[model samples]
Target: MSVSGDKIRHRYDRLAPWFDSLEGFLEGLIFRRLRKRLWAQVQGEHVLEVGVGTGKNFAFYPDRARMTAIDFSPKMLEQAKRKRERKQLDVHLDLMDVQSLAYADNSFDTVIASFVFCSVPQPRKGLKEIYRVLKPGGQLLLLEHVLSSNKMMAKLMNLLNPLMVRLVGANINRQTVKNVQACPFKSILVDPTSSDMIKLIRAVK
Candidate 1:
């Protein structure tokens, strides 16, 4: 069976045209605290956002900073470009993969991701690439839905994730903290529960 990642990507590609509607529906339903936390990390020189769905975090990026964003699906990237064009924001957008990126090592000052880790095929390889692409002391910021501490919820997630991922590129339960810890980056963890259901992490290479 093909992994859920491609299916999820395809789902997003199909949904790209109505993405803003989905974003509108998900606005208040999304993670605010983690969003703010990760946004604050967007203040550096060269900011790289992976899985930058529709350029949602572009506004939070420091106005003076250069922004480069990538996604696996061209359809998603197209919507993202349209969004950027509407905003008149000069953002570099591309169709790229997280696990194997084209950027050279130590190229970016800050690497950012939001709501994206769960679908990546090889999480460790992605992290290694993230580490390699970031300059020393450069930070990695992430805001994501993660596995819950509640055992019952965790159990349910373990069972239903495969099916849920089939319909969307994201899973309800990804242990992003464990993945961060295993990466070379020095991780700082913050778990804030409100509406967003997120894991806010800032790690340095």
Candidate 2:
């Protein structure tokens, strides 16, 4: 991993124990429903979930889908492993970075990420790695909070982003849709789940 990647991993490692508690209220009020909606559209047998933080999405995993989930933070993955054991979900969890995936090219039929790209050191590199691992016609599903299109809100987010990153290791001002579009995905469809900031993106390779 790069220096920036190590920093992000260490930040999340420290945050792992308090992560669910910190985001509990928001998760209940908004993210839980959005997660279900995102996972419902998952297709194909082989699925790769990037950034499986605390295994929050384990409840939504398709029964027949072969799930292989990866995360860069070992502490976070430890939490996820415990959750997977308790839930008895058949998921293969690995410690891996999205910017440099260990999987072979065209190995997975579907790739999923939830609010993850914001922390990635090189977002485009990670997107390209996803593109490389996905089979032709494969789908990439993302649930992300991005920079608001509103000028004032966007400016405010940009101003606050550095502090946000320092505090939580996530940027609040990423234009995730544009980043996905710049990749080689054949089609991109975006739906605003919570105003224009939080989006559900579906892109095809």
Give the alpha-carbon lDDT of every model: 0.79, 0.93
Candidate 1: tens digits of C-alpha lDDT, residues 109-134:
99999888887867778888999999
Candidate no. 2 TM-score:
0.97
The Cα RMSD in angstroms, rounded to one decimal, for candidate 2 relative to the true structure is 1.8
RMSD list, candidates in order: 2.3, 1.8
Per-residue lDDT of model 2, residues 1-205, tens digit only: 1238878889999999999999999999999999999999899999999999999999899999999999999999999999998998999999999999999999999999999999998999999999999999999999999999999999999999888888778989888899999998999998744568999999999
Q: For model 2, what is the error of residue 179's alpha carbon versus the real structure, in angstroms, after optimal superposition?
A: 0.5
What 10-residue stretch in candidate 1 is worst by lDDT? 188-197
